[model samples]
Structures are given as structure tokens and as C-alpha cells.
Target: MSTPTGFMEYQRELPADRDPLERIKDWQEFHKHFSDEQLKTQGARCMDCGTPYCHTGIELAGSVSGCPVNNLIPEWNNLIYRGLWREALDRLHKTNNFPEFTGRVCPAPCEGSCTVGLIGDAVTIKTIEQAIIDRGFDEGWVVPQPPKVRTGKRVAVVGSGPAGMATAAQLNKAGHTVTVYERADRIGGLLTYGIPTMKLEKHVVQRRVDLMEAEGIEFVTNTEIGKDITANELVENFDAVVLCGGSTRARDVQMEGRDLNGVHMAMDYLNGTIKSYLDSNLEDGNYISAKDKNVIVIGGGDTGSDCVATALRHGCKSVTQFGTHAKAPLERDSINNPWPQFPNVYTLDYAHEEAKALFGEDPRAFSVLTKKFVGDGNGNLKELHTVQIERTVDETGRKIYSEIPGTEKVWPADLVFIAVGFEGPETPIIEQLGLAQDKRSNVKARYGKYVTSVDKVFAAGDMRRGQSLVVWAINEGREAAREVDKYLMGASMLP
Candidate 1:
């Protein structure tokens, strides 16, 4: 409680983003910074409730309700309000190993469960969070602090994403030798490539990686387990193994003309664009180009939105995103989507904002299903055939989508990117390690205890829990490290 009436005294505010039209011309991050006074004002909006749900980190109604990393929200908020940014940064790092990444990419369930939001708007927790970490970096407060001592034990983390990075960081803190292996040419699996640069610049990721490296964590890139090196070899070489390889098999739309030249997976397009952009600033001409082409992105998730943004940067003539679900309400539906759960409300995300700025309308088309790809004479995608759908509940309370009559339509599409989400972890490593899998094909490791059927083997992150947010991945990674520490030593001190 910085002030008794602080929450009422201040209205919620966030830093304005760069103009969508102007930002679309370059790949730089679009978010601007707020002044210190503005950030302190935003920080004061925290209510600091007696029973604050902001840090509960629990799942409600099948979605996360609060901060998954169990961030000490109120403590940091008060510190910021008192003009103690150094203290605020320290408190923020107590739970989250990588606030910079989450601050930029996370959806901020913490805001949704804020006590202030129940009455009015939530505190700008995300904005303040980013500000704290950014200031920490600017002031040179963040630095590599390697473990003071070394244990005889060694641990190998498979994957260099958030989960794997967190696991390595914690285990190293416990005095164990840590080695992280990334199959990609670069470190930071999803963060390095899967995410677009406008949301999170690659340099930010590299900066953290450099610090981790300086802290004595060895990162091996361009090498994969179960392929370049045998999984058995990894199990034999390391005292303990933690699998954090994310669910990477992108789901495909099994429709007619699927093999057409212009039909591609969303990840493929995104990955290629990023790789080329980073490699030569897009001068290599190695990625799929949308210039002078009409693009249609299927599946309306973050990946789909990313595809839309990437297309816009490539100078696409037009773009449209397809979603099977109905458009969300302008506000939360109190009856079906009560407070404390993530609000299913409508707002223009960055990609949609950019699309609208250029195309004069939002690119998303809700409650639409793609029938098939219509190709040109030479096996190139020319157009997409789709129909409007209506949702209904069946006798057994199962939701079903039925096509509407006389609503069939075709739209020109020079390229089609499928962003329907992922299936599970690719089978090579799972099969090679002989790890048991859940019904969903994810690694069969319990949430809190990340033990696998194979002795001394563990799993976490999207590989264990299926596709999820970055915050959840960090949560699992930290928890898995604690369990691994307990297994290695008689007791564990990791929190």
C-alpha cells in the first residue's frame, strides 16, 4: 500500500506504440518507453489487496488466471511507486528468470486477475514490468553472477528456449555444471526464431544469452539430440537430463491442393523470414516473399497474427486471417467469462493494428472455415475456398460447427500460411529416449514432478504440457530444476 487512495487516484495507462503505418516499414520493435514519473504513476495503481490474486499463478476455467511465474507483483509495485527502481528490478527477478522476454511477449494474465480491474481498469503491470527490467539493463545493474562453487554433478538441458534456459540458470546456481543444447543454429528456440522481431528484438535475446554464457552455462548450438548425437549418449554423458524441447510439429490443414507450391505452414514462413532478416537483413532473398501477393493466413492465434504482420512487412498487396470461432465480445461476458479468469474480449493486437492501417480493415475473419485451396494451372495456390460456420451445442453438450447455407466464398490468395497450432514434440527425440507419452502425445511427466519413465530423465515446458505460454514454460522449468536438485542431492534449496 504505497497510498491508501492510489488505485483510485490514478487511471490505467500504457506507453504508446509506434505508428503502425510507419512501423510496418521496418523490423524494429514498435513499443516506446515511458518517463520515470509516468511509470511511477502507473506503478501506484496497484491496489495491493490483502488477498491479491495477481500472483496466485493458478489455472481457472482451463486458462491461467494470474502470473505463472508467481511474480511478487505487489512488492515490486510498491517499490516502483516509492522511486526504488533498483529494488523493483531485484524483486521482479526473484521469481522470473527472464522478465525482459515475458514483459515483451507475455499476455499478462496478472492484469486480468488484478483487484483494480474488478472495479475499473487494471494497473499497467506489464508496462511497469518492462520498464523495470529495461532500466536495470540501462543502468548496468544486471550482470553475470556465476555460482561461487561447483558441485561434482553435471546436468544437460535439451532445448534453449525459456524453459531450458531457466532450468540451466537455476541448476547452475545450485553449483551444478550446466550445458544447454539447441538444435537450431542459434540459441533461444522459440524466442530466437519463432517470435517476430517487432514484438521482441533478436538483440534482446542475444544480450541475455551472452550473460548466461558469461555465468558459466555452456550453450551448444547446431546440434540436436536423437539425431546428430544419440539420446542414449546424452543420458550416458550427463548425470541428469531435463527435456524442454517445445511442441514443434505444426498441425496442417488436410484439404485439397495441400501440396500446392504456395500453401505453407505458418512456422515455415515465419522461421524463414526471421532467419533471412537476421542473416542479411532480408537481402539474401532466402525466405518466402509476399511482395505484390495476396496472402491468406489460416488459424487465428498469435502465430496467425504473426504471419499477418510478417506479410505486411514483405509489402503484401492484401492480407486476411481466418478463425473458426466467433468474434469475441467487445467486453467480457460476466455470465460465461467471469472475473479472475482471462477475459475473452476484443482488442486490436499489434498485427491487426498494422493490417488495418494498410488495408483499411481488420484482417481477421471470425467463424469461418477453409474448405480447400484452389490452385492455379501450374500447381500454385491461387485462391482459398471457405464457408461461414455457426456453432451449436449437441445433446451431450459438445460444441459443433456447422457450415451455413449459401455462404460459400472464394478469395484470391497468392500464398496461404496455415497457423492452426502444433501437434506435439517431434517424435525423434521422444522415441529415441523411449519416454512415455500422455494421450495428447506430450511427454508423460507430471506437472510438479518432472520425472520420466527413463531413470535420471525429466521433461518440462511445452514438451511435457503441450503448447502453452512462455510464462508457463518458465514456471515448469523452475519447478523441474527444484525436483532435479532434490533428486541429485539429499535436499534442495531452489525456490
Candidate 2:
């Protein structure tokens, strides 16, 4: 257990972030490093609650309340407080295969459910989690521990994102021959391109890929399952196959003028920038430049937030974001979204904070809807016709998006990005594999048992469960690996 009076003796202090004004000028990470002592102090804040709900990994009101990977939060925290870095890393790795990635990108529900959060600020769970893994890497404690003997059962994993990586890692550890296929030019499906470099630097992702490659995992990039390589070939060649293709079909806007030249989907724009930035920072002529242009991002979620930040860095003249629902409150609403569950509170993420500092105000305009895109005669986006919306709960307790009266507004836009979220996994792979799909178009796979309708095949991650956090993907991937192992060897010794 941690020190009894630790919570009272210390306050939660996170790593300091760079000034927004300066950070927006480049694509480097914003946060400065925190010393081991400071992180240890924060880790000690973990209370000795009889039930440390932080690691429960349970679903409440349709959202997760704790660590989805079921990380031994308190155990690691106590170890960190005692300066047992290796022990903490061991505990962390027991549950999650990729703490470094989650530590950076995960929107930590664990922190939201911390017991300390009830009275004061939550423990710096994310910071401590990152610190542990970072120290492990720096100390050269993290390295490939390949299986002593190979199971000789070949496994094909489709997609190289979090789910596929986790599945490959766990299965390979169980001594299975695993090969991951990625359609993109590089490995790491979304991690390589979907996410901005500023949010999660490319090198951090590549480091893990490099490590995985060294551990006997075969990674085939620029190879689509259904296109470059036939689905039938993969199914027949491998003893078992797992589909971890993440949801990539962008949810599109059906309004008029949406096909204009300056209008683009968030992922397309983000991926293009990633490809171009690495090559020549738009000198490659493949990236859509937002420089000196009025930019409008439709959506206020993480994807939209990323779009805003990317545009600002590209030197966009102005940035404005519109959400289809009411603006979130500045703090937690105890009545609707209580503690222990991931609170649906309106919190300013890094991008919003930077935008506020640079633009003199938050770039978000909530409860707003884009009625249509207005394009110039030559097929370039010119402006956005928008309206405000009112959110009300119906008698059935379902929230309804109703348009507010007389709130039509016109906003100039040189470039527009639609970040409404993903619909489901792309249809080509599903069609090629002849896999059944749920109502939401996600691949139909039973939870806990990741078996798809097809025999000797499995599915996990966003492809199985729709858009979710990286932790859930890790959880699903681990669970799927256990099932796969059982299928391959008729029993699984994996946790």
C-alpha cells in the first residue's frame, strides 16, 4: 500500500507543457519531462481503497469507468512510490503490451475513476504510467524476449494498428508464428498516419515497430488484404487468421457542394500531411496546405481537434470548429455523469488549449450544424452555411438533435475538414472475407470470444467494436489472442 498520508501531504502535479504560442509553431511534442521524484510523489497519491476501482475494467452506462486493459494500477503506483521501477514495469507489462503508446495517446478513463478525484484532483495516472515505461526504455530494460520454441502454427493478422500489434505480440509470446499485414506504406495502421506527429511523434511509434520486428514478428507493409493480396490466399495459407482492421470509413456529410476541391475528410487530410511532412513538408506536393487560408473543421471531438491543431501549424489564417451537439460543461456534472465512470465532462484537451492561447478564444462553437458547403464557381470551397442546434432528452431518455430556429449563419472557409467520426471498417475487406456485420457495419464478433462467423477466423479492435480508445483495443487483442491460442493448440496458457 502507498503511504497513508501521501494524498494529504502532496498535490497532483503533471509535467509542464510548452507555451501554446511557441508549440503551435512546430510539430514537436509540447510537454516537458517530469523528474522521477515528482512522478513518485504523484504515484504515492493512490489511496488504499478497499476496491481500487481504477483497474476494474468494467462498463458503466455505455462508457468505461476504469482501465480497459485492467492494468494493476495500485500495484504499479505503490511500486513507483517505493522507487521499484523494474517491478512497476513488470506489473504494467503483465496487462498491457504497449504502455508507451497508451501512455501518450490514451484518454485515460482510469484517472476519471480515481478515488482521489472525489475530493480533489485525480492522481496523475497517465503521467506515472508514461514515466514508468519511459524509464524502462531509457534503462534498456525493454527488449525482445522471443519464445523459447515456436508452436509452428502460422497466424495471419490483418492490420498493424494497436489491435493487430497486441494480438501479434501475445500470440508470438505463446510461440505462434505471427505475420501482420498493413495496407499503408508503413507499418502501424493509424498510429503511423492517422494521428498527428505533434500528438504522438512518428519515431515513438516506429521504435515499437522496430522492437516487434526484432522479436520475430513479420510485418508486410503496402499490402492490402483484399487488394494487393487476395483474402482467399491468406485464409488458405495460414492455419488461422485474425482481422484487426480498424474502422476507417469516414462518416461523410451529405450536404450540397461537399464534393468541392477544398473539402476533405479528416483522415485523408491527416494521412496526406503525415506522408508529405515526412517526405518534404508539403514540398512533395501531396499535402493539402492550410497556409493563409480560412479553415473550418466540422466536429469537436478528438479528430476535429487534431484537424484544428494541424491547420494552425500549417499556418491557417483562422480556425473554427463546429459541433453537432451542445457545448460540454467546463466541469463534471455529478447528476448525469457521476464519478468512477469516465465523466462526459467538457475538458479542454491540448489542441483546444493551444488554440485558445493562440487565437484569444476557444475555437469550438457547440450545438452547431453545417447545413451545406458553399463552393465557388470553379469547384473550390468558399463558405459554410450553418445553423445552431438544441439538444433535448426525449420521453424515452434519448437525446435528440433539433435545429434551433432563426440561427442560420454563414462562415467563410478556404478549406473544410469533416471529422464526424468513422462509420465502420471498410466494406471491401468484409466483403472479401464474407464476414457478417452488425447494424453499425462493424465486423460481427462475439465479445470475450473474438470468433467471427467464419471458422478458424477471429476479429478484434475497432473492426470488431467500433471506434474506441487504444486500451480497449489492447484488451480485445489480448483476449482474442488467448482464444486464438486455444484454437491453435487446443489449450492456452496465456493470461
Candidate 3:
């Protein structure tokens, strides 16, 4: 360890974000960075336990526990503590293909499993991680180093999200000709549209895409497999194929008056706003606007949070989010949620902070169930009806939600965005390839061995495992590339 008493000597600290009220006026990343000395002090807090759980990368209690990409947490922390940023950046890149993206947007399960968090706050792993990569970019340490030789093999990766990008990067490193197909007009699938600029700027994604392009990975946008090009043609044109199309098909709420004109899917709103913002700085009026409207977001996940933030930027009059589950506790429930498992705790995320700054309180309503959407006489959404619910366990151990009598209420809602989550991958590609599906309708490809029933065809990321973290998607992509390399050359050198 760099400092034996570092964990005890320092308390956890994070860089201050831009003032919430001020940042809401425009679309820019809000997070600030720490000074070099401050970062070194923060890095010294790593405990470097004999059994480091931070990089175990396992699922516990149905939630991710550590860095799913298995990033070498301790090594980089120590390097940063010793004032070796380039070395720390090198160590960080050993596992993750894109640290800048994850550092900005990842939930950082690594900190949750940190040994220091057992008694105190976890080390500032995420901050230090972002710092290392950002420094690398500024210092020109990160550059394209293409393979010197070609293997005379070709691979086609469908989808240009994190998973597809990682898969293409690794396979190209093995000297194979790689082509990535993105259905959207731009690369970076969900990264380009699903995420708003405040969290991750679009240029960060485009920068990586540029580096990958320079490394000889072909990216073909505005072309969708099974439509613009047949699946059979892709299979015939390439030596092998890997499907990284994420789980789309947003899960929707089935309720009365569902056909209102003001009701829309969360992705549609986010995608449109981001596209317009990038295209013309929101001057095009091509996206759904929440100005002077009462917006209600129906889900409590990250997507819902983004919707809330986006609405605030659009000068919405008021906003509220609904969740079916109870509010999380202030601290971890040791009995139900123990060490190493991700803690289900309550804290104000960025959007919540912004909303509180403007609205005087948090905007989430927990344990509330929506009963129906009440529309205006002309079929535009006007309000929503809901009832409070309580949880109970039956004799058979099944969970049930019982509606409380006298708790029915109605709230004005000019626009409603459903962010309930996704069901699975879209059907067109799956059906065209005649791929087998699991019970969840995800592609039936085993975890480590990403082989499908069809020969020379593989699957990874959300399409294979359903909606999950981007870090896990990177993990699957890297492993799938290894397997594909083995299949092609009768052996593999990828890790």
C-alpha cells in the first residue's frame, strides 16, 4: 500500500458541481475537477485490502457489486497516490476500453464494495478515475495504435453502443477487419441519443469514435441489419457476426386514456431533445417541449431522472416523478443488504438536486401506483389518477401491493413521459436470424461463451443479457471478442 494509514488520515471528498440553479439554464456538464494535490490526497485513501472486493465484478443479491469491467482499482489508486498519473492511466486502460464514458456516467459499484467503506466513506475512486483519463487526454498519452498486421479475417458488429465499440476495438486489435453497423444516423447508439449532454457530452463519444476509426475499424451509420441489409447478406459478407444491439422495446404502462396526444415514451423525448440540441443547440424546435407545462414522469430509474432534468432545462412549470416502490432508506439495511452488495440507499441525484433548488423539495412520489390517465375533451393529456399502496407478503412468499382506501388522488399533468424500462431487444433482427430467445426474450447466448444456436453467429451486451450497466456490456463485449477470435484462428490472444 502507498500509505499504511491513508484511509484513516483522510475523509472522503468530492469535487463541487456547478451551482444547480445556474447549470439548469444550459446544457453542459456540471461536474468540476479537483486540484492535483487534492486528487493525490484522495487517492491515498485506498485501503488496498488483501482481498480486494472492488474488482470482483460479481452479481450479489441481484445487483452488481463491483466494477463489472474488473478494473484494477488498487493498482491505479496506488499509482495516483505516488504521483504517477500516466502509469495510473495505463493501469486503468488495461481493463476498460473507455474510461472517460464510464467515469462520467457509471454508478461506480467499485466504491460500494470498497474496503474503506466498511467503516468510513469509500475512497474517491470514481473521481480519481475520471481525473486519470482526463489527464491522459490532455497530455496526449491516449492515441491510436493500430495493429501492424492483418489476419485476412472480417467481423461485423451490429450496434455502435458501448458493447459494440468494445467488441470492435478488441477484434481490430487482433488484426481482423472489423465493420460496425449502426442503425441511427450517428455512431454510439444509445450513447448518442439516450443520454443527455449534461451527464456526458457528445464530443467525448465522437472523440473515441474518431480514434477507433483511425485504428482502422469501419463504422457504417444509417444502415440497419435485417432491413437495409439482410441478415443473410451480413453472414455471407463477413467471416463472423456479433450482435450488440441493446435491449430496446421500452416497457410501457397499460392504463386508461393511453392514447392522449401529450403522452409519450421517455426515450422518444430524450432522443429528440438530444438530437436537436446537438444539431442546432435546440433552435430547430424539432423536439418535444415542456415549456409552461406540468410534466409527470412515470418511473424512478435513471431514464426518469434524465427526463426530469431535461424538462427543467425546457422551462417546465412543474415536474413530479412516480415510483411503485417505497423510498430507499438513508443507510444500508445490513440485514437484507450486507457488505459487498450494492447498497439501496437514498440520496439526491443531480436531477433531484436541480429540482429541489427550483421547486423547494424533492419531486419523487414513492409507493404510488398510477391508475389511469385523464385526458382533456380534445384527447390531450390533462391529469393523471393514482392511489397509494402498501406492500405485503402472502403465506406463499409472494409479494403483493394493496391499495389504500381513501388515498386516491389526481394531479395536473400536461405531458406524461413513461420511463418504466425496456422489455428486450427489438424483434426484427432476432426474427431475421432465426435466433433462439430466453424466457425474457433476450438472445439465448451463454454468458462467457457468446455463441448462439446459429453457427458463426454470436451475441453480447443487452441483446444477450437484457438491460444492464454499460460496464457489464463492456465486459461481455471483451469476452465475446476473445471467443470469436478463438473460433476464427483456432486460438486467441485477447484478454
**Cα deviation of 101 in candidate 3 (Å)?**
0.7
Q: What C-alpha RMSD separates each model from the true structure?
A: 0.7, 1.1, 0.8
Task: Return the TM-score for each candidate structure.
Answer: 0.99, 0.98, 0.99
lDDT of 1 by residue, 1-495 (tens): 888888889888889999999999999999998998998888888878999999999999899999999999999999998999999999999999999999999999999999898889998999889999999999999999999989889999999999999999999989999999999999999999899999999999999999999999999999999899988899999999999999999999898989999999999999999999999999999999999999999999999999999999999999999999999999989999998999999999999999998989999999999998988889988898999999999999899999999999999999999999999998888898889999999999999999999999999999999999999999999999999999999799999
Q: What is the C-alpha lDDT of each candidate?
A: 0.94, 0.90, 0.94
Better of 2 and 3 by TM-score: 3
- Model 2 ranges with Cα > 4 A deviation: none
lDDT assessment of candidate 1: 0.94
- Candidate 3, after superposition: displacement of residue 466 in Å? 0.5
Evaluate residue 284 in candidate 2 and report its C-alpha lDDT on the 0 to 100 scale. Answer: 79
Query: How much lDDT does candidate 3 score?
Result: 0.94
Clashes of each: 0, 0, 0
Per-residue CA lDDT of model 3 for 1-495, tens digit only, reads 879999999989999999999999999999999999999899889878899999999999899998999999999989988999899998999999999999999999999999898888988989999999999999999999899999999999999999999999999999999999999989998888898999999999999999999999999999989899998899999999999999989999888988999999999999999999988999999999999999999999999999999999999999999999899999999899988898899989899999999999999999999999998899899999999999999999899999999999999999999999999999888898899999999999999999998988999999999999889989999999999999999999999
